[model samples]
Target chain A: MTVKLYIDSIHDALQEEMRRDDGVFVVGEDVGVRGGVFRVTQGLIEEFGEARVIDAPLAESAIVGVAIGAAAYGLKPVAEIQFADFILPAVNQLISEAAKMRYRSNNDWSCPLVVRAPYGGGVHGALYHSQSLEALFHHVPGLKIVMPATAADAKGLLLSAIRDPDPVLYFEHKALYRWIKDEVPEGEYTVPIGKARCVLEGDDITVITYGLMVHHATEAARELEKEGISTELIDLRTVAPLDSEAILAAVRKTGKVLIVHEDNKTGGVGAEVSAIIAEKALFDLDAPISRLCGPDIPAMPFNPPQERFYMLNSEKIAQAMRQLAAF
Target chain B: MMNAQSLEVPAMIAKRHDKLGLTDHDVVKMYHFMLKTRGLDDRMWLLNRAGKVPFVVSCKGQEAAQIGAAFALNPVRDYVLPYYRDLGVVLVFGQTAKDVMLSAFAKQEDPNSGGRQMPGHFGSREHHIVTGSSPVSTQIPHAVGIALAARMKGHNLVAYTSFGEGSSNQGDFHEAANFAGVHRLPVVFFCENNKYAISVPLRKELACEHVSDRAVGYGFPGVTVDGNDPLAVYAAMKEAVARALDGQGPSLVEAMMDRMNPHSSDDDDRTYRSKDELEEVKSHDPILSFRDYLLDCGVLTEASEKALREEVTVEINVATTYAEKAPYPHPEQALRYVFAE
Candidate 1:
C-alpha cells in the first residue's frame, strides 16, 4: 500500500482499467492532452492513444448520449462531465435515455457506462462549478450513484463501476481531489458498490455521511473522542442504494443518528438517510434524527464568510455531534 | 389506391434506377418493403380504432424515404437508431411483421421492450438495430457513438440515424452533427422531413429552408430530395453511405415528404391543416408513387402487384392475430431488468 491523493487514485483506476480492457475508453472536454481540469484523468491519454482518449465537443447531452450509444454498442465508455453543476444540461439524456434503457428494452440492451463528475463545494467554484447535485439523480431507479470519501474507495469503486453491468454515476468531491490522501492498495482492488464502511466505532452517537463530508465527520469524531463523547462513523460509499443494513446496524448500536452532506438542506441525500433511520430503526432511536447540510440558499457564495457559513467543516460537524450526543 | 400503369408518362420512367446501380429486383424489393410497411401500419390503425391497441403514430407518407434509405446500407453490418415513426426503416432492417404487431400490442413476446415501451420504440440485437426512445433527436448522438465505435473497433460499418424534420431543431442534432464532423466518423444523418411536429407547421419548426442545410454548419454536405421518389432518396442515401465508409466524414440527407395523416391517432390535424392540403399531400404518398414507378419500369406487372398485395395482407393479418392472442408479461416481471443480475 502507498499513500496517494484521491485524484491520483481515480487516475490510476482509469489507466489500469484501460490497460486491462480494450473496451474501456475515456471521453470529455479536456480529458485528452490536458489530463482534466482537476487532473483526475492525468497520464491516461499518454498511455492510451487518441482513439481511446477522446476530447468531445462542449455538449453535455452528446457526451453522455454518445457514451450511452457506445455502451449499447458493447464498449465500456468512461465519460467525464467536467463538473456536477453543469450536469443539468444532460439530465434528459441521463434520466430519459440511460436510466430507462435496460428497463425499457426489457434487458435487451444495457449501457455499461461510467459517468464521472466532480461534485460538492468549498473550492469557490461558485454556482456554475461548486454545486452538490446528487439529489437530482438519486431518485431514478435504474441509475446508481457512487460517492467515494477515501482514496482507497476512489480507486476501488471506480474499478467496480466500470465493470458493473449498468450505468453508474460516480461523483468525486472536487474539494477532496488533492486535499484527501490515504493508503491505496498496490493494484486491482474493488470496493463493492452499495455498501458502507465503518470508519470509527463508538456507542454515543452515529454519524452517516459520504463524499467530502465524510472527512469532516471523521475529524469531528476524532475530536469528540478526546472529550469522552463516543462517536460512530459510517462512510456511505454509494448514496443511491443507501447501505440500509449498515445504516440500521450503526443506528441500532448508537441509538442516536446524525446525517451530514454538502448539498442543500431541503430534499437532499440526508433526508433519505434520515427517513430510513426513522422508518427501520425507529424503535432504536434515543433522540430525534438530526441532519447537518448546506443551507437552502441557491448555492455557496463566492465570498469567504458566506462560503464558510454555507459549507460544513470539522468545527461545525463537531458542534453538531456534541449537541446530538448530549440529547 | 390508384394504379398508374396507363399514366406511364415518359418523364416518370425508371431511367435513373440503372444509373444508381439498383437492379430491377432491388427496386422491386424496395417497393415491396414500402408496401409491407404500409400494410403493417394500416393494420395497426384499425387495431387502434377497434380498441385493441392504445395508440398509433402513423408512418403514412414517408415509406419511400424509409425503405429507400434502409436498402442503401448494409443492414447486417451497420447500426441504426430510428425514431418513433420509423416503421419502414425497422421493417427493412429485419423486424418482422409479427415482431411489430407484438410491439404494437405490447405483448410478452414483443422483442422491442417486452410490452414496456409504446409501439414504434424498436430494437433487435440480432438485426444490429439499437433500441431507441420516444424523445426526438436524442438518437442522433447515439448514432455518433456507434460510428465512433465502428472506427475504433476497425469494423467496416456505418451508423445511420433518422428523425422528423422538426427534430432537426433540437440541440442534440446540432451537437451530434458537430461532434461527428469534428471526428470525421462513419455516420449518415437521415432526416425524414414529413412536414409536421404534432400540428406545428414546418415554417415554425425550422428557420432554414431544408433540414439538410443545417449540416453545412457541422461541416458536411446536405441534400434534400423528393421523398416520394424512392430512387432519388436511395441515390442520395447510397452516396452518403459510400462517403462515410471512405472516412471522408458524415453527410446529411433530408427526404422531404408530407404527413398523410394526423401526427398520431390521438391528434386532430383537421384543426390546423386544411382538407385540401391533406388531400394534396396524399396524392404524393411515397408508397403509392413508388409502386407506380416500379410499374413504369416494367418490373412490376399488374398480376405481380396483386400477388405482392396479397402476400403483405396475409403477413399482416397473421401477425395481427398472433399478437392479439399473445399473453401479456406477468405483472411481477415488471420488477425485473432494472439492473443486470
Candidate 2:
C-alpha cells in the first residue's frame, strides 16, 4: 500500500481509470500542459495522448456543456473546474442542463460525466478560491455529490464516480490535498457511493462531517477523548444520496448528534442532516441535533482574524460537542 | 422575376435528376415529408383543442427549410441538434409519425421522450440525434462538439444544427461558432429566421439585418436564403454541407421564413400580430410556393396532388389512433434510464 495524499489519490485514480477504460478522458483548462493548476492531473497528457487529456478554453460554461455533449455522444469526460468558486459561471449547465437531462428527458439521455473542483478555506486562498458550494449541488436531484476526506476514500470514490452512469460533482478539498494522507490501493478498487465510514468509534455523542471538516471533527473528537467524552466520528462520503442509514445507526448508539461542515449555515448540508435525524431518529437523540457550520457569508476573508471567525474549526466542533453533551 | 435573378435556385434545380444527387424523386420525397409534417402539425392542433395532447408547437410554415436540411443528409451518418420549431426536420430525419404522435400524447411508445418530455422535444439515440433540452441555445456547443468529434475521428461526416434567430443572440451560439471556426470542424449552423422569439420581434432582438451576418465575425461564410423557397434553401444547405465535407470548415446559413401559427398550442398569435401581417405571412407560405413550382415544372399533376393529400390524411389518422391506443409508461419506469443502468 502506498501512503499517498488526497490530491495524489486523484491523480492515481484518473490515470488508472484512463488506462482501464478507453472511453474515459479528462478535459479542462490547463489540464493538459499545466497538469491542472493543483497538478492533480499531472503527467496525464504524457500517459494518455492529448485527445484523452484535452485542454479546453477558459470558458467554464463551454467546458461543462461540451462535456455533457461528449458524454452523450459516447466518451466519458471528466471536466475540472480550477476552483470550486469559479464553477458558478457554469452552474447553469450543472443545475438546468446536466442535472435535468436524465429526469426531464425521462432517461432518454444520461450525462455520464464528472466535474472535479477544489474547495474549502485555509491555505491563504481568499474569496473566490475558497467557497464551499457542495450544498448547492447536493440540493439538485440527478447528480451525485462526493466530498472525500481521506486519500483512500478519494481514490475509491473518484474511481466509483468515473464509472457511475449519472452526472457527479466531485469536490476535492484543497486544504486536504496534501495535508491528509493514507495508504491507497495499488490497483483498481472502488468504494460504492452514498456510504459513510466510522473514522473513530466511541460510546458518547456522534460527530458527523465530510470534506475538510472531517479533519477538524476528528481532531475535536481526539481532544474530547482526554475529557472522557468518547465521541464517535462518521465521515460522510457523498452528501447527496447520503448514508442516512449509517448516520441514524450511529445516532441511535451514541444517543446524540452534532453535524459539521465547511459550508454556510443557511441552506447547508448540516440542516438537511439535522432534518433527517429529526424525521427518522428523533427519539434516539439524547440532545437536540446540534450543527457546527460556517457563518452565513460568501467565504472566508484574507484577514486572519476575520477568516478564522467565518469558517468552522476544531475548536468550534469541540465547543459544540461540549454544549450538546451539557444539554 | 427571371430565373437568373433567383441566383442559385433554378441552376441548383437543373443540376440533379431522379434517384441520385437530390433528383426529382428526392424532391418528391421532400414534398411527401412536408405533407407528413403538415399532417402531423394539423393533428397536434386538433389534439390540443380536444385535450388529448397537452401542448404542441406547430411547425407549419417553416416546413420547407426544415425538410430541406433533413433531405440533404443521411440520418445514420450525420447528427442533428434542432430546436422545438423543427418538428418537420424531426419527421424527415426518420422519427416515425406514430412516435411523434405518441410523444405528443405523452405515451410510453413515444420514442423521443417515452412520456417524459413535452411535445416537439425530439431526441433519438439510434439516429444519432442529440437530446434537446428546453433551454434555448444550449444545443449549439453540443453540435460543435459533434463536429469536433468527427474531425478527431478523421471522418468527413458533418453535424447539422438549426435554431431560430432568437437563439443566435445567445452566448452559446457565439461560443459554438468560435469553437467550430477556430478548430475548422465540419458543421453547418443553420438558423431559421422566423422574425420572432416568442413575442419579441427580430428587430428588437438584434441590430444586424440578418443573423447570418454575425457568422462573418466568427470567420466563416455566412449567407441568407429565401427559406420559403425549398429549392433555394436546399441549394444553400447543399453548399454548406459540401464545404464542411471538403475539410474547408463550418458555415452559417440563415433561412428567412415566417411562422404562420403561434409559438405553440398554448400561444395566441392574434394577441401579438395584426390580421394584415398574418395575411402577408400566409402569402409567402413555403408549401404553396413549392407546390406551384412543382406544378409549373410538370413534376406534379392535380390528381396526384389530391391523392397525396388524401394519403397523408389517412396516414395521420392511423398514427393518431396508434398513439391514442399506446399505453402510459409504468411508474417504475421513472427509476429506469435515469442512468445507463
Candidate 3:
C-alpha cells in the first residue's frame, strides 16, 4: 500500500486505466499540460499523447456530449466538467443523451462514459466554484452517481466507474483533494459500485453520509465517543442505486437515524435516504428520522461568517449527533 | 439494377456522374431510395390521419437532400447521426421500408428503440446509424466525437450528421463545430435548410444569409448547394467526405430545400404560410424535377417510372400491413433497459 493524497489516488486510477485500456481517453478543459483545474488529471497528457488526453474547448455541453458520442462509438471517454456548478450546462447531455442512450435505443447502443467533477463547499469558492449538484444527476435513472470520501475509495470507485458499462457521474469534494490522505492499494482494487461502507460501527445512533460529510461525520462520531454515545456511521459510496441492504441493516442496528450532507436540504439526496429509511425501517426507529443538510439558501456565500454558516462542520454534526443520541 | 439506365445515359448527363465518381447505377439507386422515403413518409401521414399512428413528421421536400448526401457516405465503415426528418438518410443507409413502418407503428420488433422513441428517432447498430433524440443539434457533437474516436483509433472514416437550418442556431451546433474545427476531426456537418423551424421562418432563425456561412466561425470551409438537384448535393457531400478522409479537417455542407408540408401533421400551414409561397414550392417539386432530368438523360422512361412507383407503393403497403399486425411490447418492458443487465 502507498500513502497518497485523495486527489493523487484518483490521478493514479486514470493513468492506470489508460495504460490498461487503449479505448479509454480523457477530454476536458485544460486537462492536457495544465492537468485539470485541481490537477486531478496531471501528467496524463505526457503519459498518453494529446489524442488520448484531449484539452477540450470551454463548453460543458460539448465536453459531455462528445464523450457520449465517443462512448456510442465503442470508446471509453472520461469527461471532466471543471466544476460541479459549471456542470449545469451539461445537464441535458447527461440526462437526455447519455442517460437515455441505452434506454432510448432499447439496448441497441450503450454509453460507457464517466463525467468527473469536483463538488462541495468550504473552500471559499462562493457560488459557481463550490456547489454539490449530485442530487440533480442522482434523480436520473440510467446515470450512476458516486462520491468517495477517502483516497482508497476514490481510486477504487473511479476505476469501477470508468469500466462500468453505463454512464457514471463521479463527484469529488475539492476540500478533500490535499487535506485527506490514506493508504491506497498498489493495483487493481476496485470497490464495487452500489454498495455502502460501514464506518464506526456502533448501536446508539445511526449517521448516514457520503463525500466530504463522511469525514466530518467520522470526526463527529469520534467526539461523541467521549460522551459515552456510540455512533453507527455509513459512507454511501454509490448514491444513485443506494445500498439499501447495508443502510436498512445499519438503521435496524441503531433505532435513531440522522442523514448528513453538504448539499441543500430541500429535495436533496438526504430526502431520498430519509424516504427509504422511513419506508422500510420506520418501525425499527426509536425516534423520528432527522436530516442535517445545508440551509435552503441558493448557495454558500464567500464571506467567512456566512460560509461557515452555509457549510457543515464536524462541530455542527456533533451537535446533531448529540441531539439524536439524547433522543 | 443496371438495366436501361446504365446503358442509355446520354453523354451530357453521363459527365455529371463521371466527374463526381458516381456511376449511373448509383444515381438510379439514389432515386430509388428517395422514392421509398417519400412513399413511406406519405404512408405514415396517412396512418396518422387514419388514427393508426400517434404522430407523423413528414420528410416530403427534404428527400433529395437526405438521399443525395447519404449516397456519398461509407455506410458500413462510418457513422450517420440523423435528425428527425431524415427518413431518406436512414433508408439510403440500410433501414428497410419494414423497419421504418415498424417504428411508425411502434411495434415490439422495431429495431430503433423497440417502440420506445418516436418513429423519426432512428437508430440501428447493425447499420451504424447512431441513436438520436428529439433535441435539435445535439447529434452534431456526437458525430464529432465519433470522428474523434475514429481518428484516435487510426481508422480512415468520416462521421456525418444532419440537422435543419433552424437547429443550426442552437448552442450545441456552435460548440460542436468549434470543437470539431479545433481538433480537425473528420466529420461532415450536413444542414438540410428546410426554411422553417416549425412555424418560424429562416429569416428570424439567424442573422446570417445561409447556415453554411456560420461554419466559417468554426474554422472550416462551408458551402451551400441546391437541395432539389441530387447531383449537386452529392458532389458537395463527396468533397466534404474526401476532405475529412484526407485529414484536411471538417466541412459544413448546407442543402437548401423546402419543408413542403406543415412543420408536422399537427401543424396548420394555413395559419402561417401563404398560398402563393406554397404554390411556388410545389411548382418545383424535387421528385418531379429529378424525374424530368432522368427522362431527358434517357435513363428513366415513363414505363420504368411507373414500374418503380408501383414497386415502392407495394413495398410501403406490405410494410404497413406487417407493422400494423405486429404486437406491442409488454407493459413490464418499460422498466427494462434503464441500466445494463
TM-score (C-alpha, index-matched) for candidate 3? 0.98
Candidate 1: segments with Cα more than 4 A from true spot: B1-15
Q: Model 3 - which docking category?
A: high
| Interface C-alpha root-mean-square deviation of candidate 3 | 0.6
Per-residue C-alpha lDDT of model 3 across residues B208-289, encoded as one tens digit per residue: 8989999899999999999998989999999999999999999999999998888888998989889999999998789888
Candidate with maximal DockQ:
3
Candidate 1's C-alpha lDDT?
Answer: 0.90
Q: Is candidate 2 or candidate 3 better by lDDT?
A: 3
TM-score of chain B of each: 0.95, 0.94, 0.96
* Residue range with the least summed lDDT across 10 consecutive positions in model 3 chain B: B6-15
Q: After superposition, how far is residue A299 of candidate 2 from its true place, in Å?
A: 2.7
Q: Which stretches of candidate 2 lie over 4 Å from their true place?
A: B1-20, B150-156, B331-336
lDDT at position B136, candidate 2: 86
User: Per-residue lDDT of B126-240 in model 1, one digit per residue for the tens?
Assistant: 8888888887888899999999987888997889999988888999999999999999988999999988889899889888899888989999999999888888899999999
Model 2 lDDT tens row, B311-337: 899988999999899899998987776
Task: Mark the 10 consecutive residues where model 3 chain A has the least summed lDDT.
Answer: A87-96
